[model samples]
Target: MLITVGDDTATFDAFDQSSQVHTTIPCDTSEPGQVLLPHRTLHDVVAKLPDKPITITHMGSAAQFTCGPRTFELPPMTLDDYPPLPDMPPAVGTIDWSDLAAAIREVGAAAGRDDTLPMLTGIKVDSHDGALTLAATDRFRLAHTTLPWDGDDLDMLIPARDILTLARTTWHGDVTIHHDQRRLGFTLGDTRTILRLIDADFPKWRPLIPKDSDTTIRIDRKTMADAVKFTSVLAGDTGQVVLSITSGQVTIASKTAQDGAGEEVIACDTVGNELNIAFTSRYLLDALAGDGTALMTFTQPGRPAMVWPDLPCEEGKVPDADRGHLLMPVRLPG
Candidate 1:
């Protein structure tokens, strides 16, 4: 394979390259044939490259690349070089990096932003009968989404952080995921990453989401998010924020020893019973930050509530996807 650049070119011939001169590094090909370069070396090389066209060929564990002025052969990188990453399934459904990554990032933030729960480090991907479900949970909160796929049958869980990393590094294209019980593998164009799944069983979370609600309110998502954030200063470690909805107004209030107390009110349309609810200020903020439309739906006080972007399917409209925050309420100050 030969790749050309502005003024320099690198070429590799699988048929003619002498086996004796080309050093072959042993790698874990048990999962699948893949290659990874030294993380530091890979980063430095890409950073120094000009904005010229680059060509890469996927030849199992060995890959050939040509960047401007520099032509070098990179041997396969073994998993041992870096910390272990969870292996993703070998085949992913129809791959649209943009959509897939957006979904991943949406869920990843819920798990990544808080390190309090180690299990949240992984994303539970369950594939059964052509449907794929991706879920993440941090004990106190959970985010999940479903997508249809056209591949194999199986259920697997992989590290959420590693999948997020893959999402960030990949551009719009198809990615190949290879999996067996022992490990999960991923191939995106010429890049490949393998990760080791955490052996712990992901909690049975489907039942936790509320299926019905007595109270549903629609409020401006951004406006409400800002209100909660503004009041969280007073919601410190006591981390308590109260949501009181009556008639047509929603009030968010909080109090902390150092920050004293604060409150913000926003307009909303409420239905069913009038109620007051309280939640951890930080948890509410994370749910609001999720990508969605302007309006968020509050189901009921102390019940699972969902948030949605105001206008979906519009330019910059947060996709109309299923995402919500469920917080067990805290006792209010008497």
Candidate 2:
């Protein structure tokens, strides 16, 4: 780590050589010099100091910190041993902070946690014309969302954990992105982070989404979520729940030999034919985490189901661009 102090600003730069997670934070300060500080020691000393203005001075081989009435001295390390920060590549594009954060939360839920399949642990970001698509899948289910952006055709896969961490912490307003084949960088407010791109190729997920469905049900998102929660207690080892849609209601049920069975019903407006299907309770719960105003579409007893927020749209048609989750159904044991 390297700490550089200027007349008006102070910068702290640190890099994790193995993970390729590098960050630089620059903020207003009155000090003017540079030094290589022990990262952990400096952090601990500063954190425990009084909340008053702090004064730091270099005294030959040691550094002095004065806060209020107390004084502390620390030995400084040789600045020559610090490594240089990585250079930023050319600017690729920019994205709104809120949009990027929301996309990460929506898509990251489907990113696989298994390290054995490296590609499934990444989130694919694809930009074309004026739209940006973010997607992730874990074999059993997939989640995707798109937002408006202005950029040329570009595609990249970033480690899901790193991007999600930045989105939750450092993103404040608009974020400028810089990329070049193997690496990517994000600049937000006073912090800039550079990460190495994942080398594995992401799966082609477009064809996995079914274009049409035979049954579409409009129900209160909260009502459906509640029913699933109420019935999941008996899901047992399979973590399965059955959904039977008929007439004006949808019934959710689960049962196991060791655990007692449970069922809950929610009123819903239906279109097309009545259908029955089964799914993992956790998957359905994740897909319905937001406000309960979206609709769930089903194709057949064994096909994947699509769930999306009920945004303004044509009388009876849902747009293809609406943010949603594509959840695969579980084969019911006969």
Candidate 3:
């Protein structure tokens, strides 16, 4: 890591084996020399410091940190050995940082945690019908969403951890995106993030989604979510809840050999065959996470169930298309 101080601005550069970050912040410097410091340790110490401004004095091999009467010196590592980060590609487009962050958070719900399958560990960003869509699956459930993007088409796999860290930031405004054949860069104001694009092919997942359905139902999101929470108390270790549909209502029931049974019936608008379907209790809660009425479509009793939020999302950002979450059912003998 290297820190170069100018008359009014200080440039901080840090890089690991694969990723890099650069930030330029306004500061007052007299000598305007370079200081080498440990990025991780400096981050930890600065995060614990008070909000007041701190002073840093560059020494021969160590930097002195001073705030009021508190002071310390940290010996920095050699900056000459640090490899230069790859250059950021040309600016292709920009996206609303908040919207992109939200989409990544939502679609990441279905990303697999198994590190052995590197391709399944993050969201896949690609163009669908000339629109940007994000999709992720953990084998049991899948989350798909589309967001507003205006630029040349891009297809890349980004690690969930890296992007989520960006999403968690409080920064507001559009993020300038840079991409080429080898590296991807996200720049906002004086800060920038560069990461190597994961070099693995995402699985072919379109066919796993059903083209037709045997049943479809529209119901209040809160109604089903609350019921699942209530009935899952007796669902035991399996945490399975059954949706038994009749004419105009659905019975949500859960039972276990040790514990008794719990049941709750809710009214829903059913447009197809009345069938009994079972899903993991947590999966139902995740699918029904937001407001707005949810539209659930099914193929059969034991197959996958698709959940869609059939209402207007954030204004102007969402397109007029079906964004669905496909959930695989939990199989058990009845």
Candidate 4:
């Protein structure tokens, strides 16, 4: 990267060759020429300097950084050796980066990390009639959510780790998106990111979600999550947690041959039958990692259960297809 020192100001041009990003900083410069420094090298050296203001001097063959009594001198690399950054495709639409990021985080939590099933390792981005849906599954559980999009209809399966980088990142400004058959891009303020879409096909997940509930547990989201986290401590190597439900209360419990047993009971506003349901502690923890009242539904022993942020559900009402997680229960050894 080139740092062009001028009379009035200095510019740190990272995306200059690609013309995608540019940032400026105020500096008092006596070195009016270009200093070609390795980006990582300069960043590491300067990060260790004292908090005082730093003064940089561009020598004939090297550059020196001075702060207080500390001094760091480094030679500049040849500017012609740096390769050009690949430019992103034209933007197809724009979205609030924060909003889009949050939706991804909610849905992408269930994506599988095991590499054997390549299909489940991605988050499917499906757009239709200006609405977008994101879905992911790890065989044992599934998560999906929706967002409104003002873009063309398309289906793209992107790697969860790469796509989630956008969600986990802290940035500002609306995100301008660019996509084609194989690539996806996001431009937020001066930052631009490009990722290759996964070639694998995401499984058909819609039909896996159970419609009817024989048992439902409704409670404060934080209350349930905290109880599960605390009770699961005795789960030991299996990481299994059980929920024993009654009419107005539920108990969280865990036990193993090597670890002692533990349980906690909490009152709740719930309806339906009383039963015990077993689930992976981590799965329940992940599902409850959000706000709002927690609503979980079950069909019977050994069937898949569903967790949701409690919304209105009337008789014969079909749950929102795009806004909940479907989790398969674990079978304790007989």
Candidate 5:
């Protein structure tokens, strides 16, 4: 980590080589020196300090921090030992922070946690037309969302861990993205984040998403989410929950020998034919939590089902290229 202090701003920069996560934050302070400070120690000291203005004065070989009546001195490491920050490459495009953050939260949950398969651990970002599409999958389930953006048609794979961190921490502002062959940069306000792109090729996700479905069900998002949460209690080790749609009702149920069984029925508008499917409760819950749409759509049964906020469309047609979740169904036991 490197800490540089300029006349009007102070910056803290750190990079994790293994995870390829880099973060930079600019502080609103008027300091004019540079120092190398241990991250953990600085965090601990500041956390324990009183909620008052703190003064830090750099000594010859150490720094003194004075908060109210208490004063503490900490030795600083040589700045030369720190690695230099990477330079931002040519700008590929720019996007609103809110849109990028929402997309990350929606799709990042589906990213594979196991590091052995590096490609599945990242999100594939593609820009086309006037929108940016972000997608991720863990084999079992795939999630994606699209938001408006201005950029040339291009694609990049970014580590999910780094993008999620930036999404959660960045302020509400436009994020300028820059990339080259190896590194990707996100600039928000005065803070900039540089992430090393994963070298592996992302899974071919386009074919995995079904273009159309035989069955489509529209239900109240909150009611369905609540039912899933209630039934998940009895889902047990398999963590599987079943959904059966017939007529005007959708039944969410789960059963286990040790935990017994539970079910909740919610009213829904059904189209096509009656269908039944099973899914991992956690994956479904994550998708539900990501979107704020009042109503959600569920399509198909045997294959992956698409779930998205209800779009303003004519009674019988689904919109083309809208933000949504696509979850693969698990085979129910006979």
Candidate 6:
């Protein structure tokens, strides 16, 4: 199929050389099989006609095109010309799409890259004997959950970003994960995405996750989050937001040399002894965003604090309900 660019008064071949990305011009809206330009050739041509229309035609094959002042049609694209579709499982397993997305976001928010930090950008997808375990860590905290899925063989370490993207793009449904050591593929709806898997050995993060805690606090998530965010303004590079919990009120405060100090108090149903805890405002923000508006449960003092969304997050109320986050307390400077 042949495609033309611009009007006959100033017509030119539309082609690019740098990258293989789809390009469309304003006037000529190309249809499905219209070969306006080869993928690689389209890049160079895009800059020239940023404000024009590109028209493509299917010269000798079945083709149709129509759109305002633009059109597109194409000869049949051969199988060899198209990238192969990602493999799909003959039998699929059910997974909560929202939950998987949340898991990736939670881990990505906490993961730190340092000599002391192990790789946390990887999510381990283990089709365990019966359940699929998704786990992540960043030396300071670990996040994990097991979902039911039927599959054989073993585990796959998918890059966290790829899975997060999938979460945003795909809605809940039967998910098929096809993998071949080097890449992980996800099939959802009419789209399929494949990404390279992280091959580094992930640390044994389960042990780092605290099982039992001596102190815990359950409080309104929004109140605490607002307090932290507002007070953190003056927190500077250290960005410290201190949580001082008493029998009745949980106070969040922060101070910096250039900016003054302020505190916000919110009532809470306390558990265990009251204590003072300090955390990076950044970390707490991530935790709060993940907690949504549920009654968040906080566990442990001077340790990674867990935030859990209540039993049922109100409909349309839990924007971030799919996630749970842990914040590590920072040692307040004397």
Task: Give the top-scoring candidate (lDDT).
Answer: 3
Ranking by lDDT: 3, 2, 4, 5, 1, 6
| TM-score: the better of candidates 5 and 6 | 5
Residue-level lDDT of model 2, residues 1-334, one tens digit each, is 4667776766777767413344444445655788777877887888998899777787868888899988888888888777666788688778888878888988998999898998999999888768889999999899998898885566888889888776677456788888888887877766777887888989999888776767778888778888898889888888899999998888999988888899998888777678889999999888988875777788888888888777543433544654789999998747
State in Å the error of residue 170, model 4.
2.9
The deviation in Å at residue 184 for candidate 3 is 1.7
The estimated TM-scores of all candidates read: 0.68, 0.84, 0.87, 0.84, 0.88, 0.67
Question: What's model 5's lDDT at 138?
Answer: 85
Residue lDDT tens for model 1, 111-209 = 644445555567878877666777777766677766667777657667776677767764657766677775666555544556666665777877876
Residue 170 of candidate 4: its Cα lDDT?
83
Name the lDDT value of residue 196 in candidate 5. Answer: 83
Q: How accurate locally, in lDDT, is each candidate?
A: 0.60, 0.81, 0.82, 0.80, 0.77, 0.57
Q: Native-vs-model 1 lDDT? A: 0.60
**Which residue pairs show backbone clashes in model 5?**
none
Please provide, for model 6 over 1-334, each residue's C-alpha lDDT reduced to its tens digit, 9 standing for 90 to 100: 1233443222222212211111223343333332332533443444444355443455655334434454444344443454423343333344566665656665665554453433566676676567666776565555565666666555767666555655565457655555676665555554445566676787766545444444455666667778888898877778898888788778889877778888898887665567788887876776666444544344455666656565443222221332355556778656
Which 10-residue span in candidate 5 carries the lowest summed lDDT? Answer: 18-27
TM-score of 2: 0.84
**Could you give candidate 3's per-residue lDDT for residues 1-334 as a string of tens digits?**
6888999998988877556789899998878888778888888887777778789898887899887767778997776766666688888889988888888888887888898988988778887565678888888998888887787789998777677776787768999989886677889999998877678888887777776667777799999999999999999989999998877888999988888899999998776678888999997888888888887777678788888878433321222344778899987526
Which scores greater on TM-score, model 1 or model 4?
A: 4
TM-score of 1: 0.68
Between 1 and 2, whose TM-score is larger?
A: 2
lDDT of 3 at 150: 80
Q: After superposition, how far is residue 192 of candidate 4 from its true place, in Å?
A: 1.6
Task: Give the distance in Å from residue 235's predicted Cα in candidate 1 to where it truly belongs.
Answer: 2.2
RMSD in angstroms between candidate 5 and the native structure over all alpha carbons: 3.0
Q: After superposition, how far is residue 203 of candidate 3 from its true place, in Å?
A: 1.7
lDDT: the better of candidates 1 and 2:
2
